[model samples]
Target chain A: MDHQEIIPNLFRTEYRKIVSVLSKRFGFEQIEIAEDIASETFLTAAQTWGLGRIPENPTAWLYHVAKNKAKNHLQRNALFEGKIAPEIKSATSDLYDGDIDLSPENINDSQLQMMFAICHPSISQEAQIGLSLRILCGFGIEEIAAAFLSNKETINKRLFRAKEKLREERIEIAFPEPAKIEERLSTVLTTIYLLFNEGYYSVSQNKTLRKDLCLEAMRLCVMLVENKSTGTPQANALLSLMCFHSSRFEAREDKNGELVLYDEQDTNLWNADLISKGGYFLNCAARGDQLSRYHLEAAIAYWHTQKADAKEKWENILQLYNRLLQIEYSPIAALNRTYALSRANGKEEAIVEAEKLKLEDHHFYFALLGELYTDIDNQKAAQFFERAISMARTQGDKQTLQRKIDKFRPADIPD
Target chain B: MDQYLLLMRLDIITKEAQPSPEQLQVYMKQYHEWVAGIAAENKFVSGTALSTEGRVLQSDKVPIDGPFAEIKESIAGFITIRAESFDDAAKIGADCPILNGEGNSVEVRKITSVNENG
Candidate 1:
């Protein structure tokens, strides 16, 4: 009962099971109620369990308390109706009649169903990710709002609208049919991938990387892999890609937190455990005949992870980027492939590819172009750097570009 | 146990000021989809759509054709649904198509019941 004394891991395991069970029992439409009751149950447990030894079955205790809270809510509603109050009493007493199993299998299936329902394509992509983090990952609204780079009010409106749409559409709590699984899975994977991307390169300058978001994404990936129904080769590939990328976090930035280019990062700082795990998942991804975009991206990460030096892996990285581009062509991919080309060939080839992209409007693109030009001793590139500084959105990015411009300034200008 | 009124305030002037029939048709389609979707999900309660024609009853019991005030402040339609709490009602209101137009908004407020004891 004294949950304060309980270990964090134990509490989380028990809490997740209880929450998943209650969420399923109350229906997805009653998610807020379920979450409220779960929160209250944990609060009660914290007070009661801390006074004594932890319960032998902490999960069951939490579930029972939550069920009672839900019954109390129903009774309160019944009282408002002024009907037979005794009927509410009977309902409350019958809360424990059914033996609801909270096994790992049941919880995983229910959570997976909830994830698919929340991530339905009918909802906007922003709403899908926001709802998933809130309902499935148990994130607070403020936290989700921060992750979205918006104010809490805007996020509240978006979430309210998303839930309303879901209720209005009567979106079923079920997985996509076998034939449509791959397509639906793509949306789900994309949400998880973007979730991790936000964690890796946070939009907020104050917090470069939010470990909470990264861990939540990894936890969700692990859940996907656990459930046989939802697990697929692409899911494995995405998990592998996340692992590979996360492994380099220790070496991603210097002690002062400035961005360290891959060529300058110390290879010894990479986590070997994560690299092996990523390689294993990548192998699992390769089992399927079809190759997904995640597969190609993971291959690229794997090449970087396994190489002794960035210079040795340039050609492999370029090939992977080429394959990735063929799967899904985007401005970001083209930009990245240009960087790889710079490493493989020279600044000239990189400039050609970079110029082909009509991304003058993008600050980072121009800044990178300026860097490539600087590599080739072109003073005209200083103008591009100046333009990039003007277009830069963040103070940090602007400062970095300004420094680059000053470093490559013409001889005629005073230092 | 909180009761809420989902007020759908429509800017009739904006709708009437539409430049083309195609725009009106598109707006109509959106409303139709919304009603159908809500009805299918059983979220629809009692509601009514008002005609564009406006009538004002003066103090002298004279009825005049008028919406003398700003057209932006008019209420076109509304529906009331039973919900467990204010949050539930707000969630239901989020999907209302009344707020979809160029300059329209849906306002959700809890309805307070009163007694004559005071």
Candidate 2:
């Protein structure tokens, strides 16, 4: 591969590993120093690689350079002498050796440890995601900003504050104790879910979809599932939910980058592989007695993926949605349950339930009303469509609503 | 061929002035590109990028402890290249990556060789 492709791929995979190893060795307070050494290693590679061919083994070359840089840093800085020297002196008597021990197993342990460190409860959810994107996923500040639909300055400040919090809290790069594991893991799973949704739902300036963020979230989730301590039933359920949602990714948007309603979506585009994997994870999640919201949501997503659009499918979805709403009464889930109510019951009953929701400000509330009224009352449907269009924030949603409005003629309206 | 020394002078590097490590990697790539351009033209010579710390001395005085001094900008590092004229050497120095902003500059001067054989 060309340098353009090779360098970024390396950065994405190797950058975090180096940071993990260094942070693990130097302690959490010295993460910036670790990052500096990793950055310098890449910079030195850039400086020399231009004059000569890239080294035969680039990773090894980076490790060697970073090792030497860390050694030099330890020797030069008095700060390291005070903080790190004591730890090293205690761990190993050979203080001057400066090996920094980045073995394969150590590197894996460090990265997994960092995953927990970034999810410290002391950090705000926003800051946790910012740090995860930067330190764990190897995302740049610009990329993180784009993912969050914010500006660079905001993202930079968020990351700066997050790193400061990491230092202030003195969070170690290690797994939580057994008693705290479940709670910490929940925070991590929620962050991953939010990350995936950001990609799946957000509209990009240049592109209609931001699949990169979704893929990164899945990649991190896979890491969680692979590890013994982190692979909880809730995590498996989250992964299953993600897989089911991703299976329908191809049908979410049309060629013109317009949002496609579920009824209009081509079922042929759904990925069978992901659907089967989601099924497997959902089964795995069923092994436990405790029912998390993820289990309910994954069940809901699974019902949506079924090939048959019969009343049975809708009934199953409606039940799962009901259970989910009971567990977590989010307006979005209630709004969705209203749609399922229309499918399982009828539009008339669904209309009564949807109206009682009193979610007047939500565009989807109006959109759902518009959809429920389509065959029943064309005039009311047009009115609801108009309201939905005005309430919509994104161009894609507005276009979809406008298209629905276009189906109704003025003559069909009643004063 | 005349040997010329290009001395790079810049203000003390501060955390505010320095790009974060993530950004520095990108700048390093650009630096590599610029260096490669000069290397392709066969005008490149050996250069060393200096670390931040060193001792300083005054006439009839002992060496000082740090790089901080009275000067607004200190000589950061230097490179020697073969050029026929001062203008040619200056032109070569113009492409140096560290000549980045207002306070940073490259001063090119011809170096006198004291080789008796020559």
Candidate 3:
């Protein structure tokens, strides 16, 4: 890759590494200081490399510079002397001479710790996700704002408030004790799941294809599974669920950036590697007796990955969805179960169940009603499709619904 | 090769208003990329971002606590580079990543070297 390409790739990969390392050394309260030093380090690299050749070991160069910068910060700042210095002095008298541990093991530990710190239950779920994107995933504020479909001012205020909460709580950037990990693990898992869903099912027209966030969420889930303490059955199940969903990304969207429903999607576009990984993790998840929503969802996604002509795929999906509804009764999940029912039994029975849901404000509900009405009544189908188009939040969804409406009505309806 | 000085100034009207960290990150990245491009062309030598707070010396031999009240802009930083000519230096300044808005710009000028012996 060229300089431009390499810099961004490095930013995605190394930005977190450097920040985690510095944050570990400086302590969580001075995370901003760590971030400043990391940002400056990258800026220095860009400047030096712009005028000259990139270093042979660019990662090493960054670590070396960042390490020195951290040392400088500790020595110069009076705040560090009060809390961090005594520990440093006790650990090593000559902080400058000795090599501070930015080892692979330490780096992983630090990032995992930072993840827990960011996902503390005291913070709002939105704030936790925002922090994850900004601090853990190396996303810019603008990117985070786009992800949430909010203005920059709102995003900035949210981050500022979240950081203030972190400070006020005096939260430490370390893994909780073994007994306490489970208490916060569920929130962390939920945040990761939301992050993945944001990327997988974004509502914004401009940012419909943010595979970066999905990948980042997967990476964090992998981290959770790798660590002995955090690697529970649910974590593995979540990873498995993500792998199954991500495996279908290529087939998820059409050329016009509109979603292709599962039945209409080209199965050939599914990723074999990710599907296999999903199966592997699913098996890993099954080892325990505990069943999470992730397990049920992964099972549903897995069935969807099967051949369209398979006799049992829809049946299996319906079963999983039924179980999922019992475990976690979300309206969206209920709506999805109706789709599975349409495939498993028939549209006539599914429509009866779907109508009882009375999800009046949901576009997908109207779209599903339009689909169920297609064989029964063309006029009603067109009306439902029109309502879906009107209620749709994104241009892509609106276009998809509009296309469906167009097919039914030969004459244009007056607005 | 002739030496040139690239002078930068802050055009921001509200001196007390600090940039959010996000905005700062964006500007920092832009500045780095621009400087890197110049360095790739083998023009960059040395530069440093000046602190916003500084003293100013007046003609009356008094070091006033300023960039004075009347000053609309203050010199933020400078970088020295090797350029072929004044025109070449000016051309290079076009890409300098000063935060653009009302009056942000890089003033490029050829610098005369006084150390003849070297």
Candidate 4:
């Protein structure tokens, strides 16, 4: 990459490393301080590198500057805690690398610890995801706002309050105790799942890609799977499910950037490599008898990649969704299961179950009803599609509903 | 070749107005491109960046970190470049990214040699 792109990319990649390592060293209470030092180091780079004087070793230069800045900060702020982390304090100027080890393992370890801290249940879920995006993912405030579909001021205030809460609670950045690791990992996985879902499903366009959010979630999940202590079967299942979804991410959007229904999507666009990776993680997850919502969801997603409209695939998907609902009773999950029922059984049985859902406010409900009644009752399908069109929040969904409505009355509708 | 000094005075960023890391990266890219453009023309000489935490020494009073009580901007840094005239240096200064900020300015002056080596 050219120098123009280098620092920004580095900021994306190394900013988290430096910030996490610093937070890990000093704890969350000093996180804002750590961020200040990291930001200053990059600012110095921005100005110095502007003169076409990029240092021979850029990473080392960052380390050197960060080391100096940390020392300078500690000196200026006499109100700092009486004891400083010894590792950073005693290092000589030339031996700055000794101060903060930016080794790959260290970086991962620190980020993992931070993930757990940021996802702590003490804070609100929105704050947890916001902090994760900002502190662990190196996302800017504006980027976080785009991901959340909120403005910068709201995101900034949310983060500021979250940081204050962490400080107030004296939250530690160390990994959870051995006994609590499983419990803690559950919350972390949920945040990861939510993050992935936001990226995979959000309709907010123009700034941050929904694809990036899913990829970031997968990256975090990989960290959990790589570490022996945290890599539970559920984590593997979650990763597998994400891989399957991401494999078809491109297929979900057409050239004109319109949403494609799953059944109508061109199978040729599916990524074979990600599909196989998803299968690999599923195999890893099979090592344990402990089933999770993720395992069932992974199985459902696996069937989706088969790309066949066969009864066998639909039957297996129905079974997995069946098991999924028993464990988790989400209205969306039930709605999905009803669709599987349509494919597995027939439209009549699916329509009965879907109508019972009474999800009047959800556009997807009307959209699904429209699909079910298409073959059984064309007039009802058009009415349901019309209802969906008015209620759908995204233009993509509204257009898709209109297309469904158009299918019934080609003569009456204009092109 | 005549040497011209570009003295930069920039507005200080308070805590409330601190630029985000992403914003810093964006600014850095622009500045890097500008410097590279000058270097490509073979007019770039050398430059230095000043730390905000600086002390001003005076004979009568203890050193202070400031431009002055009345001044709202401080010397940010400077760069020297080969130029034919003051106007030529001004041409380069016109696009200096630092000047993007309010109250920021680049004062272009010719660097005159005072004495020859004995």
| Cα lDDT of model 2 by residue, B1-118, tens digit | 7778888887754546666789779767876787677667776676677877778888967989768667767777777777879988888889877777577888998878622110
TM accuracy, model 4: 0.74
Candidate 2 chain A, poorest ten consecutive residues by summed lDDT: A89-98
Q: In model 3, which regions exceed 4 Å deviation?
A: A78-99, A207-209, A409-415, B1-118
Instruction: Report the error of model 4 at residue A332, Å.
Output: 1.1
Question: What's model 2's lDDT at A192?
Answer: 89
- lDDT tens string, model 3, A326-397? 777888998889988988899899999999999988999999999898867878888888888889888878
Per-residue error for A162 in candidate 2, Å, reads 1.4
What global local distance difference test value does model 4 have? 0.85
Instruction: For each candidate, give its TM-score against the true structure.
Output: 0.69, 0.73, 0.73, 0.74
Model 1 DockQ vs. reference:
0.01
lDDT of 1 at A127: 90
- lDDT string for model 2 (A1-415, tens) is 6555667778888888899988988899989889888888878877777667887888898888888787766666645556565555444334535458778888887888898899878988888878888888888788888878899999988888888988998899988999999988988998888888888887674343377777788888888887888888889999999999999888977887777888888999999999999999888888656788899999999998988889999999999888888777888999999999999999999999998999998999999999999989989998888888888999888988888877788675544
Which 10 consecutive positions of candidate 3 chain B have the poorest summed lDDT?
A: B109-118
Candidate 2 local lDDT, residue A147? 78
Score candidate 1 by lDDT: 0.74
Instruction: Report each candidate's C-alpha RMSD, comma-separated, in the order given.
Output: 19.4, 29.5, 28.5, 30.3
- Cα lDDT, all candidates: 0.74, 0.82, 0.83, 0.85
* DockQ of structure 3: 0.00
What are the DockQ scores of the candidates, in order?
0.01, 0.00, 0.00, 0.00
Model 1, residue A400: distance off in Å is 3.6
lDDT of 1 by residue, A189-221 (tens): 888888888888886643433667877788888
Model 4, span A1-415: residue lDDT tens: 5557778888887788889988877668899989988999899988888888778888878877776887566555533664546665653444434656667788899999999999999898889989999888888998888878899999999999999988898889989999999899999999999999989888777423688788889999999999999999989999999999999988888888888989788899999999999999999988756888999899999999996679999999999888888778888898899999999999999998998899998888988998899868788788888888889998988998888776776643333
